[model samples]
Target: MAVLCLMLLLLAGDLAAFMQPPVFHPNPPTEYRTPNCAQFRLPGCPRDLNPICGSDMATYANECTLCLKIWEDGHDIKIIRNEPC
Candidate 1:
């Protein structure tokens, strides 16, 4: 009877350990800037609908988008016209 009680106690302890919730470590938050038209020089530019021509002779969605593309690609682009080529 004592041996049976000891076995039951060990089984209960094992079951309790197995039923525990797992621990998780989440990734750290990254810093990101929200894009907009007003800040149309580089990093954060809006994806607007108005198309424009760049000095590099490339068409972009808009002035803001053009600036962003130019900034990314290192192109000498500027607002040639407020229309697509």
Candidate 2:
């Protein structure tokens, strides 16, 4: 029937919308600033892994991608100041 076809079309549209991956761009208008946690300055570590730009309260899952960018660009990262939590 016409009603059944209309319902199926609406359901398909709604499902398609939800299937797309969600994008989280916090600062859309501003330039994307990658945090400088940099290399593991601390010595005597089993393995040297770059630090991520997240805090005790929250974690930025996107930081892993940012770290890779900094490493590839050969940017020297240093913790200039301790940010207040």
Candidate 3:
């Protein structure tokens, strides 16, 4: 009987620990540096509607459009996210 009680107590402790919520640690934000775009001279992009967010906090029509802008203005533009800003 004593051994059974001790086992139950240990099982209760294990259950308590398992019932607790898990802790989450998010990763730190990434730092992005602009690259030189002067050497890349790309052609015109297609007229698509797939929007994407840029590191410059602007919403681009698509990845091709973003590349076109980088080639045209010679600015270091990067895609921050796939969705619109």
Candidate 4:
């Protein structure tokens, strides 16, 4: 009876551990900024709606807009993903 109780306790412990929610570690927060459009000569981007995500965590209207910002601001901005941020 004691051995059976010990086995049941062990099983219960395992079950409890399994039932616990998973823990996830997310990436560290990044510093983002809004580009100063007025301070620089803005390039005339096309009206096409090709969305893109930039390293600045902003959703540019398209890749041309992001490139224009990078060129005007002299910042090393890169494309984070192909989707809108």
Candidate 5:
């Protein structure tokens, strides 16, 4: 009986951990997009989006927005977040 109770507890813990949601999401954040999805950052521009990166600043930002919505709700994205703002 004691062993069975311990097994049950362990199973519960595993389930709880498994129940947690993933950090990344299918969609991007609306407010966290890049500047030039296809272009790179210039001298003064400090572009946001990078064509090679995940998504364009605007597109990816929109998609990544879901991440914030699901995880960091009501959170503001940093301009120079990953790379140049």
Candidate 6:
């Protein structure tokens, strides 16, 4: 009886530990950096709908966001086109 009770207590403890929420690890499989893509600029920019194609071949929301990316990430992105992709 005492042995069974001990086993049950250990099992309960194990079950409780297993039921815990998984811990979040940063960039589990691969390292990643969040892009500084923004819809609006801090100093305020024109609400132009003109999309600028980045040198990375990605179309930005506007020139403001593109400039932010360059300034923040130091990306070698340049204006490819003044239109959306």
Best by lDDT: 4
lDDT of 5 by residue, 6-85 (tens): 99999999999999998764445465343332242222233344322233232233323323332334343233234322
The regions of model 4 sitting more than 4 angstroms off are 1-42
User: Candidate 2: where are CA atoms >4 Å away?
Assistant: 26-85
lDDT of 5: 0.42
The residue-by-residue lDDT of candidate 4 on 1-85, one tens digit each, is 9999999999999999999998743543364434444453457767789787788778988777887978778987777666676
Q: Given candidate 6, what's the lDDT at residue 47?
A: 72
Per-model TM-score on C-alpha atoms: 0.45, 0.31, 0.51, 0.49, 0.32, 0.43
Error of 5 at 54 (Å): 2.6
List of clashing residue pairs for candidate 1: none
Return the number of clashes found in candidate 2.
0
Q: Per-residue lDDT for 71 in model 3?
A: 74
Worst 10 residues of 4 by lDDT: 28-37
What range of 10 consecutive residues in model 1 has the weakest lDDT sum? 27-36
Residues 1-85, candidate 3: write the lDDT tens digits.
Answer: 9999999999999999999998743632265434333434458566879897777788888777778877778777877667777
User: What's the distance in Å from true for residue 67, model 6?
Assistant: 0.3
Query: What lDDT does the true structure give each of the candidates?
Result: 0.66, 0.45, 0.73, 0.74, 0.42, 0.68
Off by over 4 Å in 1: 1-38, 41-44
lDDT of 4 at 20: 98
List where candidate 5 sits over 4 angstroms from the true fold.
24-28, 31-52, 55-85
Model 2 score (lDDT): 0.45
Ranked candidates (TM-score, high to low): 3, 4, 1, 6, 5, 2
List pairs with backbone clashes in candidate 2.
none
Best by TM-score: 3
